[model samples]
Target: MAVPHYAYLKMKLLGPKGLIIVVGDYCKSLECAQAGAKLAESLVIAEEQRQLDRIVALANETPAVPALAKEPAGEASFQPSKETKKVKLKPEDPSCSKYVIVGTRLDNK
Candidate 1:
């Protein structure tokens, strides 16, 4: 007869958030595998967030207000004296718009 399959790869029940790997047939081994999987998942999430932050930084470098057909309902909406479509780089903040380009340049060099 074949050996019965056990729920060793049940990562969702084993850790707060991760996959459980079956390292061996023993229960203790499975526990260790679950821990390792959780650690790996945490690292992966951190790296993904770091990458997204870099992209956001790059996008913020260029300042442009998207066109709104109608002004949003609120007192905050102020009508401009003249229509302008070009994106203007705000002189007040320079760091807001240099991450993506700088990061890519540094990586290339």
Candidate 2:
């Protein structure tokens, strides 16, 4: 017997445990096959995004440890031993004229 002109599209929806939940073994048209594949792809992408969001939320909810708490016992206090040299900017400098810094340190703190 001669095969039909229409191609067959086999689709299987798998669960997290690798178990098959839904199957579509026969599709009459190319459009239907493509639509089914696109739908499955979108669903997989959405599920992955949801899982990522859940992981991020769990990480955010976890309590963060203080920087000092992680230090070993008998460690000296944190301090910069070397003095930092001050950089003076000239008004006539070409690079300085291109940008302006207006914010105060208090605003940042």
Candidate 3:
């Protein structure tokens, strides 16, 4: 067993020739700690990237559905079925513009 002295960066252990002292370089220790932190960060980033890639793969596996196929538009066929009359905003300025297509279903009594 050894007694660690953090302030001096030394460890004292009982040896045949009295007490054995182990010394650590402060700069080297700092570099090692920083390197460990960087390694941890890189590992975390790699794990996150893997998760994202798996999500992308799952997304790709699903069949793609076209926008037009999803909601079949009936606008073209529906226009003929509805009896609509155009009401001009300004009756004086008549040039086939600024008119609302008002349905006559409400007036049909």
Per-residue lDDT tens digits for candidate 3, residues 1-109, read 8999998999999998899999999999999999999999999999999999998898798767545545566765445437878888889976757887777775645
TM-score of 1: 0.35
Taken over the whole model, the C-alpha lDDT of each candidate is: 0.60, 0.59, 0.86
- Provide the lDDT at 63 for model 3: 62
Q: Score residue 5 of candidate 1 by CA lDDT.
A: 39
Which candidate gets the maximum lDDT versus the true structure? Answer: 3
Best-first order by TM-score: 3, 1, 2
Model 2 accuracy (lDDT, Cα):
0.59
lDDT of 1: 0.60
lDDT string for model 2 (1-109, tens) is 2223333333445567874533234534657779999999999999999999998898798767545556654558564435343333565775763443343332434
- My TM-score estimates for the predictions, one after another, are 0.35, 0.34, 0.49
Model 3's number of clashes is: 0
Task: Give the residue spans of candidate 1 off by over 4 A.
Answer: 1-25, 63-109
Error of 2 at 23 (Å): 21
Model 1 agreement with the true structure over 1-109: per-residue lDDT tens digits: 2233355522223445754443444777669889999999999999999999998997798656656588676778763434333332554786655322122223324
Query: Higher-lDDT candidate among 1 and 2?
Result: 1
